[model samples]
Target: MHATHSSGKGRGHGGGRGFRGAGGWQQADLPPADDAAAWLTGRLPDDWFVGAPTITVDREEIVIIGELAAPEGSDDNSAAAAAQGRIGRFREETREARMQIADEAEARYGRKVAWGASIGETKAIFTHLAVPAMTRLRHDERRVLDTLVDAGVARSRSDALAWCVRLVGEHTDEWLTGLREAMAEVDKLRAEGPDL
Candidate 1:
């Protein structure tokens, strides 16, 4: 999923130092996104399935986002719980797989590559709650949030900002979907080209 911040800056550097692992791999040496996706797909258990994976290169990590497939014949509640449990049980295996990928990435990119995964619907399988993070906002941005609070859309500035985010997401669901699809395609194309 594309993360949005009021500052219009992404959380991590795209295609920068983070993408290159310190071990020796440079950006050019890193495997193509498609190749990484295929490896992950093959490594994961058949029972623990996922949709097409999208790879994101950040300053400190490589994130693979996919729809974690729910167990068949289960209701939403049971399916979610089951998925969580399964993921928890396989954490070690997942880490090993990620390390293997990281090794490859580091060898090729000349930097350390950290890997992460998200469950179906892009929900983090491990983190249970939203942790507080600090970000500096411009005067006008803060003012806009305060105005939203005054308007009664939320109880506080933070809540108001969250409300606005949800509203934007709801309204631009289709556009977001398209953007994700486009990113996947770009990954595939990058894989087909020469390394780097």
Candidate 2:
């Protein structure tokens, strides 16, 4: 469920707004200055802004980067955000400033003036998971689990696995049965790990 735009033919993925090309830095085609305020009058996408609450007028372009109103019918709460977006197609001051910045940056970094880079793919962004809700033990298993929790051995599924890896398996008459039972318990711990 993400909006995608091909910024360039070669740039097929990445950038929150369907930007796909390597060279095509898509900017919203703004209307005249008078209508500029009206441009953002209606509902805008939730994540369109790269900056917010301040609009800067440059020599060449109007650089307005900020969070916008979330579109209607959105399931999530679309309050104002500190997101950003930039408009420079019609202004000159912004262009010069950007060029100057790029020149300085390139000189500093010793690289090409590759100014507009398509944002990284949103889907590829890594995320952290909650660890507490992963494993659920039965009533009888709960007593033992509480002890492990107290010992800080299994705060998450990964923690549980680490604990199991260090386990001294019980010695029983049927070695295979004991190993099988231990493995079964490990499986449950893995599926319900807190970091899911």
Candidate 3:
């Protein structure tokens, strides 16, 4: 069954956690948005999506991807094209309203908001942020990235590293999910403990 809102559930691991890193480029403190999915579900209009959207939150942005109702009597061959057209129409139609919602969400959550729509096998994101992160790697790790770059698998070391990370993420999604759940539990326990 489709739900209008997902109560008490969201994939917001490091986004809401207070920032305590000592690096100059590290982000400032952020408001906890464990309920970001729920909040967005409730805040969005009812007719916007066929059901509840899948929301993903990180330290920099919140992305909401909702499934749009399929076009009636669309054949298999035309379905993808129809879906793409619908997505474009939806984007143009919802520009103003989406901006307003994004503004409100950004103010409330201290992170940028991005929206997307999906239909059948087609999916589209309206906007998203690509926040740069600084990292140092050992010789072995740098060699791995360099190998990918040398092989033309990536244009640069950064792209190679990103490709590697994406590969790892796709392969270990189940393990990552479990880890996130465990971390959420730890966060809950920490919140219940005495204030420092």
Per-prediction TM-score to the true structure, in the order listed = 0.44, 0.18, 0.84
Q: Write the per-residue lDDT of candidate 1 for residues 92-184, one digit (tens) a residue.
A: 556766667667765644444443445564345332224354667899999999998888878997787778778998999999779878866
Task: State model 2's lDDT.
Answer: 0.37
**lDDT string, candidate 3, 5-109, tens digits:** 244332233345433321111333677778898999999999999988899987789999999988878798999999999999999999999999999999999
Cα lDDT, all candidates: 0.56, 0.37, 0.82
Best by TM-score: 3
lDDT for 65 (candidate 2): 35
A best-first ranking of the candidates according to their lDDT comes to 3, 1, 2
User: Which candidate has the top score in lDDT?
Assistant: 3
User: Which of 1 and 2 is ahead in TM-score?
Assistant: 1
- What CA root-mean-square deviation does each model show from the true structure? 8.6, 25.1, 8.6
As for lDDT, the candidate ahead, 1 or 3, is 3
Candidate 2 wrong stretches, greater than 4 Å: 1-49, 52-93, 116-196
Q: Give the TM-score of candidate 2.
A: 0.18
User: What is candidate 3's CA lDDT for residue 42?
Assistant: 95
Clashes of each: 18, 33, 0
